[model samples]
Target: MLAQRAQLPDGRWHFQHGPMDIVIGAHGSPASVDAAHAAAWQRFTGILDELVQELVALRRPVQGDCPVLGPIARRMWQACQPFQRSFITPMAAVAGAVAQELVACYERSGVTRAWINNGGDIALHLEPSQSVRIGLYADIARLGLDEIRDGILTDGQFDVSSVLPVRGVATSGWRGRSFSLGIADSVTVLARTASEADAAATVIANAVDLDDERILRRPACELKDDTDLGYLLVTVDVPPLEPDRVQQALRAGLKRAQTLRAAGLIWSAALVCQNQIVTTGDPATKKLENRRAHQQLGSVFA
Candidate 1:
């Protein structure tokens, strides 16, 4: 299918091609914004074809030498390389890598900031002295048309300035667009790049699990014919869990997030399960032990 684009009433742009759907917003001079939008569209048009050509290699597990050739495909491979010790593929970072590529178009002069949201994964561009405030939605199952029509009641929010190393945000869960092996309601991550955040989110989300007879699972191949997970089991139904059980699952994910943060793969993360939330503690990657004194972050479960 051919790529298509439309301008929303709020002045943002919506672009779609095959499975890729993106919404972009920017703040800049009229001429600069127009130019950036045009450039992004041009770049977006051929992305699907480029990925299709290297689809086989992209679906393989990330190990040994990189197998993809395209720029975006290579970015995806590199992003997931850090997590190669586990079962992960370049597909885990595809959405974020594509958004990051399009965001580059708005990095020129006169454009103070720009954001590209590929589904729920996001990539940001900020000039010197610029910053952006991001809202948090911890649960995807709770999202509905009323929430969209009346503006989302954010669970929390945090501000990212130019000085901070964060420029990307991503979320993962059993209820999200991608298949998840854990029972977390959501796991949102912040990192230096969109692709890194996406990969880390996937890794952390898979760690938020606990054995219970009520949790139903099925093989990934049974649900999606081309899934990279092959015959691995993925969460399908997570029955209402006890409060203590939710905390147990969230703690598992939190440990994974902490490890990624210590390795510099992720800046911070917020994980949710059954209305309970756990974060990586500090957004600046400092004072990770003092979680209660988190001044730079707000409650993500609100």
Candidate 2:
């Protein structure tokens, strides 16, 4: 299928083809910004087709001697390679890889700042002294419920001048578009690259599990025919749990996030399960402690 592009009312560029949908915003000289958009569109046009060419390999578990011809597919493969011993497939990094690729296109055009948001996985380009604020959704599915009606949902504001290592952000949960193996309401991760954040978010979200019978799971393939997880059990529903149980699940995921952070696979992570939340990373980076509404974004540094 051919890729389609449109300019949103608010001035962002939207590109979509197949399952990949991206929204991009850039700031710089008008000439550079326009060039970046053109480049992004050029790079995005054939990406879905290239990925489809290697769909079978991308879906397979990473192992010795697997070959893929597409650059983005290779990026996906490399991103998931660190977790090869696990059940991960290159597909786990698809969204982030796409975001990263598009952001790279923008960077080459000399944009001072840009962000490519592929679904909820984001790749950011921040020139020195420029920064952006990001909205953190504690639990997207529960955003509008009475419990969160107070509108106290906190938004994370990052100053690129202070925390330069982070350029990618991604979130995962059972309620998200993708199937998850754990009960985390949301698991957001930051990394040097969007691909890493995407892979780590999936892994951390999967680690946020407990043996509670109230959680519902089903074979992933049964829910989606082309799911990379195949027959692996994926969380389908999570019923209300005691506060203590929520903490237990969040702690489990926290341990995994800490390990990944120490290993340099991730910069930081915010994990939420029910009403409980845990964060691991550099303390200097801003964090959202409590949030009640759906995610909202605002600029922290102009």
Candidate 3:
């Protein structure tokens, strides 16, 4: 049975179906928000079943003429198609695609602003003269004691103003729910859509690797029976590294991020490892650092 939908005390709509979980928020006329929520819930019910029907194809690496039937599945496939020459599967963009789909449901309702966060892969809609503040965390482990105590990191916030081209945000790392082959503590990316950001984050995080013996890895399938990565090695643990080696790893990831940015695949990216942070893309995104100065910050969605 699918999980029941619930409205949390914080006023967010939560939906869970098998491994797919989503949180939705919107700001608009009360009637519009209500209509949007109803629309999202109506669309959310059959999504999991649709993907499950195509799970086998979705788990495979993208190749010429790959078959995918469902709307969300097709979105996932299309989002990862640009990186088909690399080692990526449609599953890499699943979360973002799900988020984007829900956002689409809300967009037609005429909400001033709405966001659908599918397990940290977020799709957003903003009208003119509107903006939203999103929190960002470099390294989850480096969060201060207070933040740890509160079970959140409130420091890093980014203003997603309407003037910006960004509409999606995604984060990936060794510590996240997904399997990562790199040693990055976290890598967050912003793009035109949630699926695009999701795919880019996966690629950039995978590039943040090194040949160091201190990093432990195991086959992805060993950790999760259904992982799309098959026998590919995934990071399990990362031991202490020299500052120079850390720089080397970050630089490698940064180069890949810059290349993606130049390709117009992403608006910006922030790669973090061992507490050090490197950013690529628009200079304004670097302002995410300034928000860290406030003490009353909360945890990042990822």
Candidate 4:
């Protein structure tokens, strides 16, 4: 029932278990697909505990390498290595790195239609005739702007009518399960892979912020035990954005999404703020029906 897609693994090398909020898959013999999934989980299981155990070490200022024991940890170090020239922790890029590694595993195994998803971030390997549908979360899921005046944005979960062709979806916002530095209610992104989409979502969500007191804010750590955003308060609440201010915030995120798309890092971005929905992909605003109607149709690409 959770809005996710993951295989139930049985074999073992290590790292695969639980409803890991994310999953990777490929189209092949049930056996082949199962083996591939087993391998991925074997690699992922216990990584969270290991990472948490080493969280302090992860936070310390490392001049060079922190060569940890966990394979995922090593990957995390390498991902952040590029930014080490500055001061980014290996954890900053951990989500993407782990996803990339798993995707690489499935690819090496010769699986055509394969994917590795982490929570919402993911990596994918699709075959011909295969496509994915991703949903966008309104940043101001609570912000009743014109949607309230116009009676568009309702106070309820988004409903997807009928199933769609999409196999991947991710949502990032200040109000979601994870953390966001900006003020967007939700920013959903879809791409060929989850890692790219995940990274891009991070980039875009950061764009949907009100630079002024236009919105309340705090440090990332204040809200969570350990957040990639060290000193920045995850956006708390928006007092009340003027019509123009809302447009400006949405515009900034759209502009940033364009840059990400141009870089070939993102296929499309769906930025939702309160009631204003801005998209740059197949699932455009017009294509989306009202929430209740959508759920009836089953708007999932899984």
Candidate 5:
């Protein structure tokens, strides 16, 4: 089943359920928070069934003009639209789509600034002087498998937020919850919205590796009974990579990201593997958390 969960809180209220995994809270009137929660739940209810239904329809290529019945489904289709001919299914961007829709629920209302965090793909509406502390996982391929790439890419766990104008965050790597094309552990990107970030992350993740036979791969459908990928092979495993090979793989993903960034598809990105860190363009509205600051701070100081 898809992972979309939601939750609302008053006094540090913690909520979690379904494929829509979210941890959200607002700073405003109680009524505002309640409204946000209700909206989230409204969007949350019956999503799994809806997504499953959509998955059934997307089993094969679009025969003709397919009706857009589900919100997330429609969004998924739109995300994959640009690369439809390249062999992509809507399911690949489902998490980001869910994140976008749930975030919309709050925006629909009159919330000054709100956040809808679905797992790590978050959509945010920031009022003036608002920000989010987005935690970045170790793997970049978490975005999706890059069938075109040969191996994997990885980085240490960290945090980065997409604030104000920036609203989306996504990770792609072979080591994440989702399968990856490259061997990268994680690749994160932040964009204007969760959907854009989600889609862009998939594209970048695909570029993280070289196309070679050494990497183990399996069809997406084989990995699961109700996968959106149908017969497409999702990245499953990776063998050791030589020093030069790792550099080549990282460069491939980086080159792809450069093109994407130039095209305005993304605002900023952080590419990490082994112990190396490569940041391209600006990191968008925010920057990485200074690890040294934490270390320098006294243990007594938070």
Candidate 6:
């Protein structure tokens, strides 16, 4: 089927083509908003086909010269390059790269603030003095349609301001659309670009792990024959663990996030598993808001 789009009741636009389902919103003059939406749609129409043409290289582990020619594909590769020391592929950042591309259309004059949410991966544009409040959902499996339809019953919330140097947000977990080696319920990251956040979230989520007899895992290829992870084992089921074990896993993930933050690959991150949470920054200092019932989407490939 061809790409399709519809306007949401709240004035946001939803664009869907194959595996891509994006929600775009902008606050600006009517003329600018309309033009940006049009431009974004025009750009979105051909992205899937472009990625399809380079699927083989996109699925390969990051190493050596870039293998994809498409702009978005190259962005994905560059985003994952910092983690080339690990086994990351360009696919890890695909959703965020796509969102970033569309969000660019809203960066022109008159658009004070705009956001493109590709599943849970997001790209943002904020002019001077503008900001946006983002809700967080600690667990994707518990995200219901009602919560998404109404206001998300956010577990926590944070504001991203124009001065913050943040423009991207992404989440990943074992329970998400993509395979994860760790048992985290969710790992959310903020970065200077959506592609970086997506890649970092994936890496951090994969680090939130510990040896546990109750956890079940299977080879990535067993679940999806064409998965980029190949024979790597991925978490399938995680049983309730002792409190100490949970803390151990969260600490491991926290360390990984801190390393990325120090490297400037990520601004901050929050990791959650089995109801416990860990963050790279102090919540009070960061002014992050804690609330009940807010929901967020799981990370997915573009």
- Taking all chains together, each candidate's TM-score versus the true structure is 0.93, 0.90, 0.92, 0.66, 0.76, 0.94
| Candidate 3, poorest ten consecutive residues by summed lDDT | 293-302
- Give the worst 10-residue stretch by lDDT in candidate 4: 292-301
**Which lDDT tens digits does candidate 5 get at residues 31-82?**
8767886777776766777886756665544334655687778877766566
lDDT of 4 by residue, 141-221 (tens): 443566545744332233222233233345567775666777777676654444445546666787886777667777777
Per-model C-alpha RMSD? 3.9, 3.4, 3.0, 8.0, 7.8, 3.0
Clashes of each: 0, 2, 4, 39, 34, 5
Candidate 2 lDDT over residue span 49-139, tens digit each? 8898999999999988758978899989998898888899999999999999989877754688999999889899988777777766555
Top candidate by lDDT: 6
lDDT of 1 by residue, 192-278 (tens): 999999999999999999999999999999999999999999999998889999889989999999999899999998887877777
Q: Higher TM-score: candidate 3 or 4? A: 3
Question: Which residue pairs does candidate 3 place in steric collision?
Answer: 153-298, 153-299, 154-297, 154-298
Better of 1 and 2 by lDDT: 1
Candidate 3, residue 165: lDDT = 89
User: Against the true structure, candidate 3 has what lDDT?
Assistant: 0.83
Sort order, lDDT high to low: 6, 1, 3, 2, 5, 4
Mark the regions of model 2 whose C-alpha exceeds 4 Å error after superposition: 142-163, 284-286, 290-302
Write the number of the candidate with greater lDDT, choosing between 1 and 4.
1
* Residue pairs clashing, model 1: none
Over 4 Å off, model 4: 1-20, 24-26, 49-92, 108-112, 137-170, 191-193, 212-214, 281-299
Instruction: Estimate every model's Cα lDDT from 0 to 1.
Output: 0.85, 0.81, 0.83, 0.56, 0.61, 0.87
**In candidate 2, what residue range of length 10 has the lowest lDDT sum?**
292-301
- On TM-score, the stronger of 1 and 3 is 1
